[model samples]
Target: METAYIETPLGIASISGDEDGITSVSVTKESSEKPSTKIPVILQDGALQLQEYFQGNRTDFDLKLNPAGTDFQKKVWDELLNIPFGKTTTYLDMAKRLGDPKCIRAAASANGKNPLWIIVPCHRVIGSDGSLTGYAGGLWRKKWLLDHENPVKQQSLF
Candidate 1:
């Protein structure tokens, strides 16, 4: 898989994929890995889309994704994609949608294991009490993303 690193408001984002499609998109505080001299053609769309997302110009991703995971995990990840921009859902809700409320933990596990970061929108999942929780990218980053997608608009004081 070809990999490319780009600077984002969050940090250095590593995007990896091939002709098959984008396989992974991850962020790190820092990385010894050098930025791609040239982003591979197959990965350029995903890279551009991610940049657009961070810029707040794109609400939803429209690139081909080919994440690797078990069937159950894939089901969970697919459900995550249904979460709209600026919206959040609880793990229990996700479990119910998956046809078994008892699978909340399993669903949560799959959410944590999601490989495609912002693209899959796993950060959109929150605790039952609406608290931020269990973001593989870090809770701080999750908060940043949720705020980015749903920033509080200043009201006019007439």
Candidate 2:
């Protein structure tokens, strides 16, 4: 496995991957001066894609991903990918879609464990009441991402 740290708009992001594909991406408030492993090619591609996304030139990510998690977590992550850009969904809604409305908490927990960050679209999930909830990247960055994707048009004010 290889790892690298990328400085993004939100903060310093740690990227890790191997031949199987990118495994994890975590955003932190502090920078990592040294990584445990050499940077990999897969992570290099992911970093480029993230840069494009922040620039608003990319809506969907194309890099290969292989997030490590439990079976249920993988299912939740897969469902998250279906969430379109510029849109949002609640944990309850996702739980209902999964055919288990009572599993909202589990769904939320799985969403929180998503390792791919924006590429996995975990930021699109929110509270049932439409309020922003817990975000691993911090609520402010979550708000920024959601607002960036769903920009308020000038016509809306008119």
Candidate 3:
């Protein structure tokens, strides 16, 4: 595995991957000078795509992903990829789509564990009431991302 750190609007992001594809992306307040492995081309590609996404010039990512997780987590992550850019879904919605209406908590947990971040589109998941909920990168960042994706139409409130 290889790793690299990049600065993002949310925070410093650590990306890791290998020839198989990008494996993980995590956000943190600080950057590590000594990463545990080398920086791979797959991670670099993901970082570049993320930069384009934050600039609002890109909506979809094209890099390959190989996040490490259990079978359920993999299934949840795959479902997350189906969430269109600038759109949102609820935990219950995802759970039901996955054929387990009672697995909302498990769905949320899998969402929280998503390692590919924006590329995986896990931030598109929201509370049942349409409020921002748990986000591994922090709820504030999640709100910012959603707002960035689906900007509200400004109107005069008389």
Candidate 4:
């Protein structure tokens, strides 16, 4: 797979894929790899979408994704995609949607293992009490993304 790194407000983002479509997009505190002088053709659009996302110019991703995971995990990740921008859902809700509320833990596990990061939007999952819960990229980044997607608008004091 061809890999490319790009600087993001969150940090360095590593995007990887080939002609089969984007396989992964992950963020890190730092990366040894430098931003690509020539991003691979397969990854160019995905990278641009991510940049637009961070700039608040894009709400939903529209790139081909090919995240590797088990069938159950794929199901969970697919459900995550249904979550709208600026909206959040709980693990229990995800489990119920998957046709078994008892699978909340499994759903949470799949959510935690989401490989596409912001593209899949596992960060949109929250605790039942509406508290920010687990996020693979760390809670701070999750909070930043949530805030960036749905910033509080200042009210007029007329």
The prediction achieving the highest lDDT against the true structure is 1
Residues 93-150 of candidate 1: C-alpha lDDT, one tens digit per residue: 9999999999999999999999999999999999999999888888999999998998
Better of 1 and 2 by TM-score: 1
Q: Runs in model 4 with CA error above 4 Å?
A: 154-158
Clashing pairs in 3: none
Residue lDDT tens for model 3, 1-158 = 87887777877778888899899888865655444344466577787888898888899999988899999999999999999988999999999999999999998999999989888999999999998889877888998889889857557899
Give the Cα-based TM-score of candidate 2 against the true structure: 0.89
lDDT over C-alpha atoms for residue 23 of model 2: 92
lDDT of 4 by residue, 1-158 (tens): 99998889888899999888888889865667577788888888998999999888999999888899999999999999999998889999899999999999999999999989899999999999999998889999999989887857557899
Error of 3 at 122 (Å): 1.1
Off by over 4 Å in 1: 154-158
Candidate 1 CA-lDDT value: 0.91
Question: Which candidate model has the greater TM-score, 3 or 4?
Answer: 4
| lDDT of model 2 at position 116 | 92
Query: Rank order by lDDT, top first?
Result: 1, 4, 2, 3
Ten-residue region with minimum lDDT total, candidate 1: 28-37
Which whole-number lDDT from 0 to 100 does residue 44 have in model 2? 74
In Å, residue 52's CA in model 3 sits off its true spot by 0.6
Cα RMSD of predicted structure 2: 3.1
TM-scores of all models?
0.93, 0.89, 0.88, 0.93
lDDT value, candidate 4, whole model: 0.90
Clashes of 3: 0
